[model samples]
Target: MSVPDTQVVVVGGGQAGLAAGYYLRRQGLDFVILDAQATPGGAWQHTWNSLHLFSPAAYSALPGRLMPPQVGEEYPDAEHVVSYLRDYEKRYDLPIERPVRVAGVHRDGELLRVQTDSGTWRAQAVISATGTWWRPFLPAVPGRAAFGGEQLHTVEYRNPGDFAGRRVIVVGGGNSGAQIAADLAYDTELTWATQRPPRFLADDIDGRALFDAATARRRALDAGRTDTGGVASLGDIVAVPPVREARDAGLLKASPMFVRLDRDGVVWADGTRAPADVVIWCTGFRPTLSHLAPLGLRGPRGHIPTADTRALAEPRLHLLGYGDWTGPASATLIGVGRPARDAAREIAGLLRA
Candidate 1:
């Protein structure tokens, strides 16, 4: 096979991509990072205005740089994170192309062909760090099409002001659902619904604890011991300041998920009806992996089965920062470094061999 264009090509310039770039640069590898966004900060730039980190800045950081502290705030907000990410890319001077939407990745002899909006390039290895934010998942709940009120997914929700004076139902029990519901409690007639009772971690619990638990879980699994469920066993929600306050004030109580949606609102399993002017589905997201479909690698669970960060069927492809399947807590800022480091090291070793 002819020489490839570069040693590696990293898709998605978010936290995960940047983390991978850090290690790739350290290894002196020739790589290019293609980011879909027009600018830096990745998904952080698109989160709700009031969104804050689950932990303090010290605990939430990318690989090389520690996120600077935010004045007068324990946990940094979305803007702070965006600023930090922009600064990180500049500080590292990583070769990143902006607004480059990768169309697909396919095998080309001994190299992988990365097709993007701009053009196509071949690399010895491709690291897909595209996280889940782009593909917001909305469940196929009954009567959803007939619901007369406006329906919005978490990605479309920017602030609570848009929901003022409106009767709204926030669906899903995870952090997004809890945080968004808390954000709207004071401004809207809100009902928070979940399939099961919402689980809130202790007031003292934060990202640090969750990361440690996830690390332990990974070690346990590697050692062929029983898994401890990691962060899921602890709780669903992180009890951030806004969520905690809302719950303490009795404004963020959880209700059982409605069986179906009506023209006016949602219908509970107990034959109760709640009138709603809007429904915000914070139902979470799926990994943005459509770009990889050309490879025909996705398994039955709608995921590309992998061992560590490398795709099992395609050793040249590495899926980073998707979720635990990629690495323990790899979706988080701090958690991504370990996996990115490993992936970069492996790619470098392969190139050398």
Candidate 2:
């Protein structure tokens, strides 16, 4: 087969990919973005129906254009965010190939060969922006397989209507867990479980503040200043409307994680069991880096060691939007732009050299 070549091949067309693309385009690099999804929107398309940005639309935009404000909505919902991302792709006239699932990436001497379902893209450098939505993680609790009731990860969750009247337990302490538990509380007999107590930002603080705090923390660390105890993480829960409503209704409390699963429910460490019909594991995701396994860059924890976004072992490759490791709050919308710009600049310098 004849292999196509480009200066750069971005491995995913989600937020991270698009952000990187914006910088690459400005740099006038010859590149193409390959997205695995059939359509635009990336993981946002699969988020629960009521899922909304913890930050306002302005704070959630990519590099080039601001996300258009929603009149009645303080936070843009999943559909709105997806629409914005789709439009962002078009507005920039980004060269994106859809339905192109990347199989693996291997180094061929000086060039990197990106193996995709459609064909191979031999490029000078590669940016792996394939976010973590595809790899949901469920903890290995005892008797997990023995539980007879329905079990799901947050990825499969779409709407709470299907869970109505059922006794459901939502697991994890992140935003997904909080929002999902809140959504289902009104419809289902619900329980929320976390490994530790859920941390909530101040009521006045939202995504913007979280982003600022993250930025400050990053800056402090870079300057060798260890005093950043007040910085909040992007993963901390933002008091979105639904969650606040749930809190007001006395349904936002979280229980300690159950030690094991039983036939009809879960058992706490104290041996108390609660009947459950469904358990939604909102335990987060592992990076989707199976394609990069051939590179042998992944560590024992399933992460690629990177100096900023650039791989430590392989400078020709970069990983974006996996989490804080790639860049401070790089997994978030507002936080991705800076690392993407820096990565694009690094790639451009390499290509020019």
Candidate 3:
């Protein structure tokens, strides 16, 4: 039995990973963060250029540092977020090794062996926070493969100008779909299709409201009360400036989901056809947990069941920033702090014991 390289090895450097690092450092733990990206900012760097936070800059902050507000922008865009994350890392002086993708995590006696592209690291505790950005999910609709025009996922979409002069269909009713559609509404011929009517949050609802609701729900559950059904009960889309403007201008109307795709367009169940040269699927993403396959903890839905943030089957392992399963709104920049702090404190206590 040899000494482990560190007490903990965080498997990402994105918002979630950075949040974990802040708490881990405060705990005075020996840890290292492994980020696949060569640079910082995590998934924010990869999002579409026009992407903006759902909340104001003042509310979309990490645990220790507040993100600087973007000048003249209520909702800071992707570039602002990337800049903030890069500076946050420098301010915190976190130990992060970039471009070192983790291959897998395996059990080694009492330690967890993390195999990465750079080298293998052994740790007493492992925080898997790779997130879902890398795993863009495209629904398997019939005849999708036969579509002649370009079909792209939310991950691949950049801006509306890219699809100019083309008949485009933006699929999904989520925030991504709404924002992207707004971006293309005036630039090109656009059709927004969703499984159901899109639901928009109240004008006042923002990331702060959502975070507060999530916190209340968490507190209710902890107190053994009936689930308050926090943010989940709210509408799906947060009417950000772009989305709101488009909606108010009657440019963001949603059509029922098309039945199938033809070479040139989509067909509704009613046999009405809408021609399209491009289909942008803003469906959603799955957690990036291929590295955890060796642990055999993922359930049928490709999620690892956990109590709080710690894996039930493997107490030494914790999953953060994936979503509510790890912790309520743990995927958000402002929402991840509580869970990250709790996980770090637990890991420190266990190692100390």
In TM-score terms, which candidate is top?
Answer: 1
What TM-score would every model get versus the actual structure?
Answer: 0.98, 0.97, 0.97
Per-residue lDDT of 103-220 in model 1, one digit per residue for the tens?
9999999999999888887999999999999999999999999999999999999999998999999999999999999999999999999989999999999999999999999999
Q: Candidates ranked by TM-score, best first? A: 1, 3, 2
Error of 1 at 51 (Å): 0.5
Per-residue lDDT tens digits for candidate 2, residues 243-329, read 888987898989999999988999999989999999999998999999999999988689898889999999899999987788877
Per-residue lDDT for 1-353 in model 3, tens only? 22349999999999999999999999999999999999998988888888989998889999888999899999999999999999998999999998998999999999999998888999999999999999999998878988999999999999887988999999999999999999999978999999999999998899999999888898899899999999868989999988999999999999999999988899999999999899999999999999999999989699998999999999999999998888989999999999999999999999999
lDDT of 3 at 17: 94
Pairs with backbone N, CA or C atoms under 3 Å apart (clashes), candidate 2: none
- Top of the candidates by lDDT: 1
Candidate 1 off by > 4 Å? 1-4
C-alpha-based local distance difference test score of model 2: 0.90
Candidate 3: clashing pairs of residues:
none
Q: Candidate 3: global Cα-lDDT?
A: 0.93
Residue 216, candidate 3: Cα error in Å is 1.8
Could you give the C-alpha RMSD of every candidate to the true structure, in order shown? 1.7, 1.4, 1.6
Better of 1 and 2 by lDDT: 1
